[model samples]
Target: MAKRGSRRAAAETQRRRQTSGRRGQERTGWRLWLRRAVLWGGALALLGALFLGLAVAFAARSLPSYGALKATQPGQTIVVRARDGTAIVELGPSPGKWLDSEQIPEVMKDAMISVEDRRYFSHPGVDPIGLARAVYVWVTGERRLQATSTITQQLARNLFLNSNRSLDRKLREGILALALEAKFSKQQILELYLNKVYFGGGAYGIDSASRKFFSHDATELSTAEAAIIAGLVKAPSRFSPTADVDAAVDRANVVLGLMREQGRISASEAAVDPSAVKLKKDVSQNSVRYFTDWALPQLEILLPETFEPIEVWTTLDVGMQQAAATAIKGNVPRGAQGALVSLDRDGAVLAMVGGTDYVATNYNRATDALRQPGSAWKLFVFLAALEAGYTPEDRVKDVPVTIDGWSPRNSGGSYAGEIDVRTAFAYSKNTVAAQLGNEVGFGTVASMARRFGITTPISTYPAMVLGSSETRVIDMTRAFAAVSAGGNSVEPYGIVKVTTTAGDVLYQHEGRNPTRLVPDYVAAGMTDLLQTAVSTGTGRAGQISRPVAGKTGTTSSNKDGWFLGFSSGITTGVWMGRDDAKAVPGLQGGTAPARAFAAYMRYAVKDRPVEEFQTDLQLPEWQLEPDDEYYYGGDPDEYYYVDESGNLVEPQRPGPGQSPQDPFPADGEQPPAYPAPRQPQYPDESGQAASDDFLDRATGARPSPAPVPAPSPRTRTLTPPPQPQQTAAPRPF
Candidate 1:
């Protein structure tokens, strides 16, 4: 029984051991499975966290840099104003002032927030809920929908991004919006958005919108006005009051409803009739159209890439400009046209009239027209003569002469009989001028013209001495201005200073010290002669109450007429002619051009105190000593000597079949062997003799002229001749 029990016990014990072993194996397997499940869950969690981290890094790399985000800037308007700060015209696409958050009204702010982004103050530049709603609407509704871009996102788009409907653009906008929120406070972001938002009619910013819609400042805006401005942001042109008043009013009503719903405005304010809102009339047309058109290109040149509003203080004098235009229109004939340019001694254009009416013709004749100046160009020739050691009191014969197969006749068909140089210039005698031009080299006259700011190319022909060359009226005006400035060369300019609205100067005219082109004695002498002409000579019509001096010019067949004159305070030039260069009957420089000049000057100098021209009346002493050894040292017998009587005697004529040799050149062209006379290098304020004072300082060498005949007291009188076409005075005063 024990063995059996033992055997049974062993078997039972073995079975029990087996059963316990089986239970232990089962428990171990369950524990292993639990361990494997926990490990797998932990591994999956780690993988997800790693993937999320990598995604975040990639997104951060794709974002704009911090510096780029800080570089956001909006376009600014360029405002050109008169000297007194009166706005003349505004240039550029945006016309508005930058308003600070404080300058903006609370009503405006509330209206903008209520309509644009309700949770603007709470959200982080992007509204997730609004975007989700937009997506739901887009999926469910039949109409297309747009994603909600916060004010910050809108500002980013306006400043740095283009408007494009795409996922990539939206991602960038959202990234920029978040970056903006991170960089700036809520108030700063709102202020930037208010200033950068676009309104209709080329207006940007809340202040500009208010001014455009209500004709008032943003700070003065009412709740209704604010609502209307807020509604313009979505589609500025579509909601423009100038384009569609009804549509704009409806849009404003929508904004007012939203404002009322958001508790931004009272019920009474929201209930205001949209049609009763007094919208301002658009003053889009600039008053100073001509001046702005003239100055626009210059502004572009000063700032090639202007992204902000600039303030340009120009040299335009409004009163004088109007007066000039009035004078030109009133005096100019119905069929003919006229142009006038009036400038101060400092080359500031006080007044300019390009045509009779700017609306009739946009062509700016004052700066563009190139016509024959006729006797108006004689100033240069007279200057050349002065440099050649000839005085205004010197005598020259006025006789009909032919040179180079071209014979020039005087208007009267009669000789003045050995007239003085001053009388010849005053009477506009052509023959004497031709003789004088031949006497003094034409090259010298051309040089003097260039010195006086005449940029047109001058011909070497004697006819050119009579103002046959064409030149712009502005250039002629500038040339006369140099003379008025006491021989200082002047470059005509209009712009004075250009600055940003922030007062940062972009460009400023740095006027150079006046540089003298002629000696004071020469200028004074010329002024004296010109005064005589204006007072009693051909240009007598140009006489004003105060002492005035000018020259009259009439081109061939009366195709162009001109008068250039100056006072101590101002210099003006007037030109009259047809665009096609047609001859006008009875047109004379003394008649029409002189009259126009006087008319404009009468108004131009009305307010200014009378100022007299600077004059140094001391005459140059004449000291001539004979020297047989010439500087040219060519033919000693060819040289013609000036006698003590101041008469230029002619040498014996060459025999027949032998070309008559001229001792000195008859044409204005300078001889290569003999160096031409030097002009003033630079002007001094005191009109002192500057560099190479060849004229002011005397030299021992005497003037050795090639033989020329002295003026005869006796000449044949011609019959009364047929009246020729009205032309420039054969002699420019």
Candidate 2:
């Protein structure tokens, strides 16, 4: 038994030795493999490091030198100011008054960091966690290449890089961000970022933005206002309070929530009332930008090109501009746009509203849009007639007439035959205008329009007598300003002077001289007709506290409505129409356009002394002798005329053959006796008819007459004029 145990122990020892040897061999093989694997991994890591280093070098090679990057230059800055020296707008990259770190509100900084970069101060230049998450989101198609740029990185990009999203750009941005961090402290970087970043509407710094939107300094920014401004850094144009206040307020709310979530503010502080955010009164009036934009192009001609900042003193009257804007906003119908231009007798532009909203569109309808003037073109036609020796007392027949395959009829469809020139003009009888156009020749009419300062091309077509030629509101307003200036030609001008910020005059409007476009007698006669139109005829809606001489124009199919009038040394023009020239339902020159003109004129002339128009010509009375058959009701003794407020007023009866006359007649003689009243007649059915076609073809729909409001308590209550009976003949205007 002992011998067997010895043998088994020997075998077991041999087996154990063999197993231990195999185990040792396996351990030695594993260690050899581990060393090879470690060497390969080390080499791969070195290659990657080399590649990364080369990329860094390549991106850094094209970067501006540190000094050059720090020396950033802003673009040309042009400050447009109103006549009163109020800054209207700043054009170009203006680095507004730079606020130091101490001046910047803490709320502003907190809001920006909370919304833009939560880990801004802790990160060197780029946050690894944010970068990784951004990459993951981009790769997984969760967002369109989300930007995880830190505030430092944003400052770097704003200072030295273009906004390109390529990997190379990102690499350059990252490198520049790190360099910026190394060069400047956190507060300095934040200050630079706040001052350099764009806040839209031509504002570049927080100070400028605050002044522009809040009408206050950045030092006075409330918590809500700071949030609003901080949120604009992401999308300035889209979040601009002037462009879209609701959008800006909503974005600010998001910023406020972020501030609260980051413990920068309390939940109660995060709750912001959008109504508390009010844009500056002037800032809210974006219509002023239209004038600024228009005047900007004129600056190039006024001064030599230079990088020095310029201040252009324009003729824009802020009060008048606000009045015009308010008038248009309150009166212009929905789905349509309105434009107004007000000029002094010397042609200084006092106010201009280009469209319904300048933010929605920058198109300057007052200066850029060319639309048919409708019957407002008749001013030129009648002025030509007066120059051709026709007096306001002269008679013209309103019979149906065809000229060059074009037939013209009145807007009322019926005509008052054998009416005096003053009566025909006040009533806007298209037949008489066409007759005058043919009698005086189309060239004479066109020449008269050009003489009055209409710069647009004039067509001499017979239809041109009815204002078929497309013209701009500015040009038409200037033409009327000539009459207001005693027949002197007016060149509409906005810029009074252009100077450097140092007060050196670059340009001044001093050399131009006024040229007499027409004789004072002709102006008087035209004024007589215009006064009649406003006092008792179609433009009664345009009357103000002071006397107004104006004309009403409604284009074919009512696509455009125009009221051009002059009162109290100011000539203003109002136009309402669709941009696409589509007809506005229930629109007419006698309606909204006339009311808007009156509304603006009431405010514009409120402070100015009331001045009466020169009526020296032997003008006939505007009263239309009532037709016995058409006279519906009321006593003949109650014959009335509409006063400035559209109230009916009784006139003093004249002695036999002693009619009312101007105190200063041109010939120093009494005006002619009143002509026999005529009956209203329809177009002759047997008259040779021409195609009733012209520019902006008429829909042959008779326009509804201007609505007369209920009489005031102090005014005489009289019977309103009988409504014109509609006929089948096509309406001409």
Candidate 3:
């Protein structure tokens, strides 16, 4: 009975232990389930936040509505047309006519789709696959090399969004692209993109670019031409055929390969020769850029600043422009630069060639370059003297002259002695000009230049008489135009008429009223002087078939050479120089510059009838005679100083803001003899003796000359042209 009770107790203990182990297993299972639930809840919350952030960012910005697009038209292009109505250049943007999807060539569409976005038709605005690949490459690779934007996305970004690569911008671009896709069909979207995209050389759309690069319409584009235009979408200027033909051709080949790889074209269809698609010779390259560039600034003067399509009828003669370019290019020495400008008597720009190659450098040397006028400036000095009662026959000594211890020497350092103004002017004698400058105060010389339309600053120094002052070719040309126009002040103009597309005339320079800037007699005298220059002086080589008159100028060290002259109808200025201001060895105004001037004028005047420069006044024989009054012009009332050697002398004019002393002699004695030393001597006041201070020449006054008749504006007589003789060889001096 005791053994049976012990066995029963052991069995009971085993059953209780089994029941406790079952309860512990239940608690462990519950803890595991709770942990997993918390993890899943956190993950779902993070994902929800990301989605909410994206939605809020996209919702805050308003996308461009189609209605807004209709209201905001692109800027109207300013089309610059030649005088003959030939389209020269479009200024504001590409001015291609809008075409529908049907008008666009299939090859062009394929080229664009293959290179820009292959899945354009299938993608919903943004390409998910392309975006994913781009993201993966950006995170794992060294370069961010994948293209993520679809055609719709690119159009959206181009039209509505800035080209920012930030996450916020990218999200917005994607969202807006989806909106565009929802609003328009694929055909409509493609047409808009093709019409609005930029394709270099100031061209805007496909059709304009087709004409710009291939000289045809978009539908007329060949497979290779289509590829060239399609490749320009990446970087228009870099792949433009006119800018870089080789690069453009290479880029087009890449487009062809892309088309073939995408199955848009067969292998045979993609095998078009890029070389055979000959690019249209850029009409801008045909010497039209020079005219357009010169006239661009005048737009502000011609019309309002608003961008509305308008036509600018210019004064540019394409024939003369070509002639000018050829003359300058052919005659300019190698490594040296040349600029030539031609204008009508009314200051209408006829032809302008700024440099050898306008493409290589857009720097317009003809209008912008400032250079020394050299002895060519003597024309104005003599003009001032003529107005101041000195004749061309009046003699000025070619001997050395010293003014305030500053002595001026002739070109060869040898004097021609006493010579008439006509002969001195013909040879461009430096000493004689300096003496004349002193005779009529340097202030008067500067004033004369101002009257002739030289806007550059003129120094009062004696050396300025030798063209030491800086001047521009255009300004000097306008000044010469006054001589060509018979002394009328000509304001240079380029635009003849500006009309809106609506046919309303906005501006018209019908013609300038005749504003006389110089007396008829003075103009006549100047004509004679310049005629002599072409006939027998430094500018002998500048003479054309008909009568021509002008002056030649060469600065020190051959730094600047110039030939500025005019025929009956046109005035042209040619300048040759090194841009760095370095000396061009053996260069002179009468050589390269004269040759260019002659060549251009010969062609420029080919169509015009021969005419003479009109002037009524006769040049006095005494005007061409050598006299001493040409060197010492002073107020008749001003007293003359007598030196210790009994010689009459004129006092140098005082500088600005200084008063003059009494004119009477202290001893009240008569003045000494006139016609002092042929060479002027400026002895220091301290070094001169007291006898040099007398006023004596007044007692020898001659009878006053007869008053000349006032010139009639209606009377214009054509002087007989001087017979052409053997041209004088330009002196080396």
lDDT top scorer:
2
Model 3 Cα lDDT, one tens digit per residue, 259-285? 999999999988988867877786566
Tens digit per residue, CA lDDT, model 1, 533-628: 898789999988998988989887777888899986699999988888888766778887788888879888888898876654443322011122
Candidate 2 Cα outliers beyond 4 Å, as residue runs: 1-68, 71-73, 90-199, 205-285, 618-733
RMSD each, Å:
18.5, 17.9, 13.6
Candidate 2 lDDT, 1-733, residue by residue in tens: 9999999999999999999999999999999999999999999999977876665565556556644643576457888899999987777875568788999999988988998899889987778889898888999998877667898888777777779889888877887776666656788788888887788877878888898889888988899999999999989978888777888999999999999999999888888775598777544348998888777788777778697888889999999998999999899989999999999877889999999899777789999999998898999999987775566776556666666556676875686766788888898888788777776788888988988878889997777888888899999999988888878888888999989999999998873688988878789989989999999888999989789999999888888999999998999999999999998997888899999999999999998898888877632322121121012222333233444563445545567998554433366644223222122222443331222221011122322122123211111101112223322222233
Model 3 stretches astray by more than 4 angstroms: 1-74, 90-199, 205-281, 305-308, 614-733
Candidate 3 is scored at a TM of 0.62
Weakest 10 consecutive residues of candidate 3 by summed lDDT: 712-721
TM-score list, all predictions: 0.54, 0.58, 0.62
Rank ordering of all candidates by lDDT, starting from the highest: 2, 3, 1
Candidate 2 — what's its lDDT?
0.78
Model 3 shows how many backbone clashes?
Answer: 7
